[model samples]
Target: MSLHGIGLVFLAVLTGTASVLLAVALLRWWDRGPGRRGARLPQGLDGSLKPMVLLFRGQRLVDATPPARALLDRISAPESEWTRLLQWIGPRFPDAIDGLSRIGRAGRFECLGQSGTGSATLRLLVEQIDSDLLRITITDPQAEYAGIVVDSMSQQAMEEELDLLRRSLDQTPMLVWRQDAEERVTWANAAYLRKAEAQADEPIGWPLPRLLDSPRPVPGAGTRTRRASLTQNGAVFWYDCHSHPTGDQTMMFALPADAAVRAERSLREFVQTLTKTFADLPIGLAIFDRQRHLQLFNPALIDLTSLPTGFLTARPTLFDLLDKLRELRMVPEPKDFRSWRQQMSDLESAAATGHHVEEWSLPGGQTYRVTGRPHPDGAVAFLFEDITSEMSLTRRFRAEMTLGHSILDGLGDAVAVFGQDGQVIMSNRPYRELWPGAESLAEALACWQAGAEAGSGVAALGARLTQAETGLRDTGLMAGPQGQLLGWAVTKLGAGRQMVRFRLPDPAAAALADDKAMLASAG
Candidate 1:
């Protein structure tokens, strides 16, 4: 009951109260570990309302909320996949576990329910509390961003990164797409939707194979581009697609190849048409390309040149072809061996201007007409035609005409021939002497009046000959100015021709001419 006893008891009560308060503070600090500092779960979520959440230390599932536990029980099948926490989460559980184990500090991924569980996509968020601890919260993906706060700098950086990714995908000239194991379209860039002629909203859940007529490449095959086609805007579009497999999905890149395919088709058809046309050519044809290589030849060429088909098919150069032609005696040989190369060069130059021509008279008495012409694309075409028969006929006709002229010259009578156009085309030597003053038969007839006034009776001969050529014949007598008597005849020669001949008269005609001239003057 003294003062010292009362002070000691008050001190003991104060020490006990201090000790209890310190213990409570220590317990509170222990409960609020690094997990609380880093966790971003919803602040006001009740125990019953919050989505499933689980924490892992290394590979071990150390803690789980009530919803998490319930989900694990519902998904786990004791007979099959109930061995570990990862297996209990069902399909794609290893992906989640790998992320949780290997993430640097924080990460997020999508987890989908397997079979017919009807669970919406879960957005799994994982944060590292310490080097060995990871806190995971799986929530509805739609609400995953609800309780998260980001600093301005970090948010700006993320937005920039997202914008760069979007621009990269949109600006690329190729189509980029991603498909799940079931071959359904999960993501496609703007290029892909445009190529498929589909709206952006239609690609999700679309069957990727339906967009093209090509079959999917087998899995594990090396990455090789395969050609495929699509019908868009009522026209066929072509693509060369390259695929890459990653985990359970495939990524594809497609480049437009429609132009290349169309070009090839056009070239093929053009060649076919050329072949058909050349097949029927009678004249030998040889077409060389821009590089001076023999690109085409007809069957007539093979037969005309007597060259082997294989040699022509090998696409020999123009010089080589010419050399072969010389060796085969198909071309005319040049006289000077030293100038042959220059001659060939000159031939090429002349062919470029499309004026090269040559006649080949071969050892076998055959003649060929060869012509060189310019073709498209800096090419040249050579044509060969056999003209032996035509030349032979022309020579024969000239010889026959010369023989006929010799026979006509032997006749003593003055002879003149008129052609179909009423032109004097021929006169024998005697006829030229008889009509020394006239240049032609028509001129002689015009001057006959002068002869008649000088006492010659040949005035009506020209009119009679003209009538004979039109299906009439006349015979008459006449005298020249030297007081000689003559007999003349106008005869039809068929084919619109007439011949006029004059001969010395008999004795009776000579006497009759002299007496008739004196009697006419007296009358």
Candidate 2:
């Protein structure tokens, strides 16, 4: 009876084992679907690929492969939670999280290893495995395997990077500051503190305008650069400010530019002064720089040169200006066109040393006194003055003198002009014949005195002339050439001058007059 009972228990155990084997075979056949027939699945039954296969349900990590667990441990993540995994690798997989929430539900991302380690990049693929499940597969597309280990020095490296950025901000010459979304300053560099002259009591919460009068608008969501000014220590200062926006904050940098601003202002003032001085000048003035380009010209220069204001404003070169002047016939005419340019070149060379000066007679019957003088800093200046009226007057005076000489020479009487110093200044042809060897009025008088019988010659006449008053006239006889007696008369002229005239004797008339006088006396 005991054996039969044991046989029945063994038979029952054998039937249960056959039913379990048949159920296992059916489940295996169902798991091998047609979609997974050609898909390359990872080999190795020891769960080596398990860490790389993550299963998610309702955005939660329900299960993970062995590779994924190894990766999370290498990244030094806190727990096996989905949030912790995303946080661990979010910096490297920025686009993956966004794509996971979208329809179609397929995304790719790059997974980087920890800092300070040589680790190969992992290509991560996420796709919907079912309606309520997602599968994440990590693979090395380049087939280069590397250990995904987190370096122990990652925290130290991050701290060092932050310290380096802070030192850079402090050493930079530009003033740098950080502001929060509420427009409240949160951080400022050493340069900012120095430029603002901030006291120890001042904190980051201080108003921006109080440190330096900032007039620019607050930066929005982009980058911008602008110029601004402030008054410090009773002096105006300039700066070039730039801004960059972060997620919820903005960074600003202000560089000093006061020197450039002041220099530009001084140049403008100097140009204004020069313009005023040139405005009042009567003579034509033109100035050229070292490059031979015209830099300045006065109004007189435009009028005298007859060049258009637009042409001058275009800043023509010196050669171009002269060429235009020549075309207008405003300058002196040259013998040859080619030679004229060469002459201009020579003039420029000579003017460099301030040794060029000339008179230009234009075709318009105008005369100009042109002078070229060297100016400071390798510059040149040209001056033009109209002298036409003065030259015309001189010509007219010479012509008058010639006509007066011709009238005096045609007279029958001998005439001589004397100055206040008793020097013979002018004489006609007749006077020259009478006193051929006399060099001066004093010499001629000396000859007459030598030829005189007593005091009746030029000596007596000279004495009488000296005693005569202004506007007085006197007549006398003087020994002429060939021992002939000539009637001489003296008349005082204005401006300390005297005129002397000599006349020939009428012998026949005098003798007739004498005979008549004798007959009258006898009767």
Candidate 3:
């Protein structure tokens, strides 16, 4: 063979070797598709990449990560749940026939039964593929770290945290609890356990029927009652219970003491606030019996009565108060003022009617208004106000009116008074000087309003002065034989009546003569 031919053969062999290596690499990459394509899956049991695994349902652990071991260690059931884990395994691994064929596959593993493997810790794997291949890369928590792995450390940490949490719950003045699927106490921190001991005679693990308010059909371990607590073995606890369904089990918790105490405090505060509001009311308030005796009275009543020594003075009878009022001139003295007889009659009539007794009045120069009503339950309510200034102003106005009438009469001219209804009520004797034939002041008013010597408009003016009022002051003019009488008149007496006055301008000599004649006549 030639040197060039040998070189060509060597090159071909190298090419063939490279091809085989490429095929092997491709096969490995394809088998790990799930792990190579981004972060597609969670970590495996040993925190390695999640390799392709074969699982048999009902025969393996539920979780496939290190955290799962720490978590599952707390579960009460481990082997009993194996049948459930078998459902998670692939179909091919458990269905195979040849054991050798199952054990021959490499890079395909399983979670070999957890057993003592001569060492405390060891990497566990099946190193074979079969009908129920459970490929896994497991590290025995007891072996790899020589019993120093997360099993002990994580458990210690969890227990410490639980202790701290228990202390927190115990510090509160409340009962706290955790219940199992059967409503039996699965866990009870110190506070709840003590209370339970006081109420229930049994310790933990007691049957839920003897411990809780179980439903008739047991509610399948997931039923709960609100505002209710487990009463284990004659023990009673108050709580609001709620059940959380986790697979075939349940969990429950509650806090009762704090809730009830807070509710009671709120109700008491509300009642106290209501009572204070009624007691401190600003309005004068009083309660009287059917016999007219005072039962309850507030500070406002005392201030109104101005009882210098206080109202507790001898429990004065109703008649006694009336007598005192009369003596003080606060009430009309029957001996001095019989005129109030009509007012008393009106009051009786008002009481007989359904009208509540109410009136405006002034006491010792203070004005007030009061109202009284009968209580349906044989009591009475009285409300009053002060109105003194208004009544005083009214009396002053009446006195001034009388004085004005007297001055008008003293004018030596014919003076007259008319009621608001347009009827003449009073007049001086001098009115006859103007019309001697007039019999009464009413007849004189009729003639003057008729204006016998006046034009049509003047008489109409007299009629208009008596027109219904529109609640406003009105003025009108009346013509008479007295030559443009200049009788300024105003309609103020209501219902069309006016205060009409007139006088002829006195001639200088005639006025002097009249003044002297009147004086001489007086003499």
Candidate 4:
């Protein structure tokens, strides 16, 4: 055989061997699949056909599988990839981040998702790749190993319930948020976000800004509440913040309190105005509550009662106030202390049911008109009025009237005064004796006509009594019922009144008149 022929056979054999090796390598690569070859998932998570895996170095995201990347993309948050991933996973596995510390000691740890998260088989796996690197794996063990079978009806119901809850939280007017042990906000509802945005100069991001100041000595077990305020666009908004501890985190809710705050402010202002008005009042006023404790008083009360300001300001009970007044001699002197107490008890009862009035004649010669009135809600009010001057004036006027009446009774002639309405207003003792039953002007005129002669000027006296003119006077002679000579006169008085008088003619004047008549007859 020739040498060239042997070399050609060996070259052909080598080329055939190389081609077989290349074909075997291509077949093995095709069997590995795109998931295993294209994206490098975490070690244990590679078995999943579509694993959601993320790798983080400290707080920065080093890498993520395609599914994890898609999840991060679906979450709309202005935060880094690590924060975005945590936001997605935290609701399902609340302890996901908390368990990371344990991974450093244990190398790897697993946690189950919260119940009612739609899938009971959900799990999260955290592994410490190194001192600074962490690998997080989220999967459904049932779906991966045992095959997941779902009831469509139950799934739809759960989805509907979740949607309703989401809508309710978002549409609520209250601001709700959850905070971690570090007092950093982890989650917030739509309302909270809107408020944060309104107050913030920049766009809101992850770890949402806290709307209310964190309560000191962190709330535990039960709920704690406080009032909080926020200013937006120069307008202040008020809220009642309620915080309730939930597991390792806290759930906080802020309800609108603007209306309540405004109402309280208005009530305070109204009370201030009432206090000012009472201060300037002239009438002494003291108001006691339903419990009989002094609640309100005026400056006039202090001046009139002469009670110590400190004692009044101490809010003394009704009995205490009365006892102090007795000690000060500001009240009427009672027969005894026991009787005074009984009287006060009755006064209180009467005042509560209706009005009560009493005149206190003090030892200091001051008369006080104390009035008690029932106030709303079973309360009683006492008004102390110093009526000393008024009482003195009234007594003096009454004495003057008595003196005037006595002077009229001492007159020698019968005098009667008639009012404008033709009613007999006043009569002296002699006048009453002269006309026994002349109670009015008409009756008096009838008596006079019956006693006097027909041409005795009785008609002229009636006309003068009835006239509206003042300061008119007339006098004449008349024959009495006993045939005796009588002198009569009518004088108009003030206020359309008239005075009528009657007296017997003097004997001396009658004799002189007789002598004159005799002389005239002889001539």
Candidate 5:
């Protein structure tokens, strides 16, 4: 009973083992079979297996293998997948697209990739799959057969980085290009191509056209910049071209400089206008920089200071200019040399913070009004104005006024003059003595009315003095404050001025003066 039961268990175990072995063999075969998904590889140019394969139906992508899909994914273009693939291979195999159209009749075609595209070892095969379908197979014999393995993630990152770099270079606003040692343009970005097209009024092609002219004294080892201009449609555009040497080739970049150039031109024109204005000014103008060195001077400065034009043009310091003036006897003589230096220092300090004015009486009997003003950026401007004629006229007018006042004082009668506004403008010493504290015309009128006897015409006299009309006169007798007889007269002067005079009226004195004249005649 034990042998039979053990035999049955052993047979059951053996059947189970054979079934498991058969299942394992079938699974292995299925996994390694040609019918497995993505296991079929397209034939290469030499009839070897290639991993990269793509099928197209009249410009439409129908199917692609894993490596081909990865390559298409790596390429970035704003075009259909079939067009993108063509673009990716166009540089490597320029005739690949043309060969595909003829593949229907030829059945197959092969092309070797071109150099400079990093695909020289690549081989492309185009074959007719059906009446409307075409197949393309790209193979790199070295990479496919040489056991070269690449991490997919790393390759994807590298492709993205390359795409970003290409986008940045193409979209930048600045024009960029590369030239060989012979100054032949080798490469250019999209911006460069656009500018070249606009300038030429046509499309741009390979071996880019040169935009900026070659600078005088060719660029050397380091970066060099030159200003270049481009005229388009009757307008000039400016650019600052920067060139950098890279090995035997040179890299160039052009930045727009139109705004900067316009600003500089405006500044130059303004300076020229200012120079012309300064040249014609009568007052001597001297402008000093922050360092106190003379930066600008007008012709009047030379004429006024008697300074040599050569010396002023040499840009002398403030102190040096003062020293020259002192030597030429143009400046007022100082008490001592040390005091003069101190005075000069004080002048500079005052002029820097605020305005300073001084009067100089030269030895040649001429007077000058010198004004110093602070300017922006710690600069200073000095103006020298000749005021000799003005001073002389002022002195002459003052002397005439003094002489007139003396003549008025010498009069025996008390005299006071009133303006049209009824304000006392002039008064002699006698008038002041007669009417003490009577300064204005109203006060004088009040004093005369107080002293005058009743019905003495003082009110009438005041009305006459206040009238607007000129060339009128009035005379009368009034009693003084002491009861003494006084004679008064008011005569209108020109420009609405009135002159009033008062005198002591003595008939006895008049008779005495007549008898004395008779006695002297008898003697």
Candidate 6:
């Protein structure tokens, strides 16, 4: 190499390096133009900045900043433009820019300018470096940042909701599975895997058919099957599986088909068991709500209430049973069903109270005793027992008992009142009518009256009279003896407390006939 040639080479290299450095400096200086020149926010700043495509070139403005979501919402014009047709009618943009007529000079924004109806405020900030490649930040009046606070709260709430859903479904002893839009498994709770014998380590990314039995997949098409489930081994199970597009793919889930079948079987068994049990029960049972609405009733209830055919008592809504209650339910003497409105009010006021048993005498001469208990949710269970036979017997006994009092007033015959024992108590009206009133019956029977209240005398008379009047005792009838019309006068008032009245001739014979009539009335 000669010295002269080396010097020339060095000189050319130096010139090229200088040119490159100068170009780099110019570019850096251009980028700083906006910042160095104290580019300040415009007065009364209201964000209305929008990027516009220059009409001179076939180009588009693109933004992929401030999170992908916000950027997309900004650039993609809605199908129906935000601008009105009337605004574009009388000259647009450039004509409306205040200072620059025929040329829009409103900083860096696309806007309706003045003559536009419902004119709004707008501001623009141009961000450019070097020649022209630019990004214009558009600030619209309605735009507001949903800052970190909202984002944090939203994320927390979503996490809690998902956690709760997971816990609820987990406790259910059933397998569950979920798939993503790509048909890949996104979630499968523990039960889903445990319930399935052949669950894979992870069910993600497998084709939809791969999770099931061998099946063909047609692009963009879907199909289902009931073959040997991929998740279960040695278990012949059916799954209702389907897919729906989520985002780029579909999400799918598999639920046990047997669960539904089992539920149906159980419901059927329960209904059958209840029908048998209800028919065997002697007491009628009808359940009603606080509103006096009947819910459940046995066959006896139907017989007693004369319920209609094809009545589904199990599902009777409260209002439905009101009609039935109005028919069969009744109240005893002095208290009728019509006055029972207060009972319903009090039952609903307090929770779970044991109320008094109510009785009713039906127009058909039948007696129905009703008792009710409140259920946990304010529903009441009403039990009705037919006691017509019992009540009839009781009333007859009372009538026969007072008959002695009727004769004691004046019978014109020899009469003796015993205190249920053989001890003579009173001579009665016939004696009082013949010998005049003597010691009161209670005083005369002194010793016998001592135990009369509790039937001590009553038991004694049964034994004493049994021996005295064999014929009368056999027929539960007794009249004065020494006369065909009368064997020995005897009467019984009660088992616990006894009163006996004896009469002669007509009174005794009349009493025997009355006794027969009383017993018949009781039945």
Q: Pick the candidate with the highest lDDT.
A: 4
Better of 2 and 3 by TM-score: 2
How do the residues 1-523 of candidate 5 rate in per-residue lDDT, one tens digit apiece?
6999999999999999999999999988997888785664433434443366789898899898766777788778889998888777776678887887678789999997765412235678888878888888776555644112123222434654677888899999888888988788999988988888888856667677788874533545477789999887799989998888877788888888999999999999999999999999989999999999999999999989999999999999999999999999988889999999998898889888899999999988999998899999999999999999999999999999999999988888889988877788899987888888787878877887888776446766766777645554488777776677777888768887878888865568889999999999999
Those runs of model 2 whose alpha carbons end farther than 4 Å from true positions after fitting are 1-277, 280-282, 436-454, 464-473, 504-523
Better of 2 and 6 by lDDT: 2
Please state the error at residue 161 of candidate 3 in Å: 55
Q: TM-score ranking from best to worst?
A: 5, 4, 1, 2, 6, 3
Locate the minimum summed-lDDT window of 10 residues in model 1.
146-155
- Clash totals for all models, in order? 0, 9, 39, 0, 0, 19
Choose 3 or 6, whichever is better by TM-score. Answer: 6
Q: Could you give candidate 6's per-residue lDDT for residues 143-198 as a string of tens digits?
A: 34323322322343355457778787777654455554344555666665555434
TM-score, per-candidate, Cα-based: 0.50, 0.47, 0.30, 0.61, 0.63, 0.37
User: What do the candidate models score in CA lDDT, each in turn?
Assistant: 0.70, 0.73, 0.51, 0.82, 0.81, 0.50
- Tens digit of lDDT per residue, candidate 2, span 162-195? 7788889899987888777666667888887776
Worst 10 residues of 3 by lDDT: 113-122
Which regions of candidate 1 deviate over 4 angstroms?
1-204, 213-270, 413-416, 425-444, 447-459, 465-473, 478-488, 491-497, 502-523
TM-score of candidate 5 to 2 decimals? 0.63
The local lDDT score (0 to 100) that residue 26 gets in candidate 6 is 89
By lDDT, is 3 or 6 better? 3
lDDT of 4 by residue, 317-390 (tens): 98999999999999888998899989999989988898889899999999999999999997889999999999
lDDT of 1 at 132: 75
- lDDT score for candidate 6 against the true structure: 0.50
45, model 5: CA deviation in Å? 32
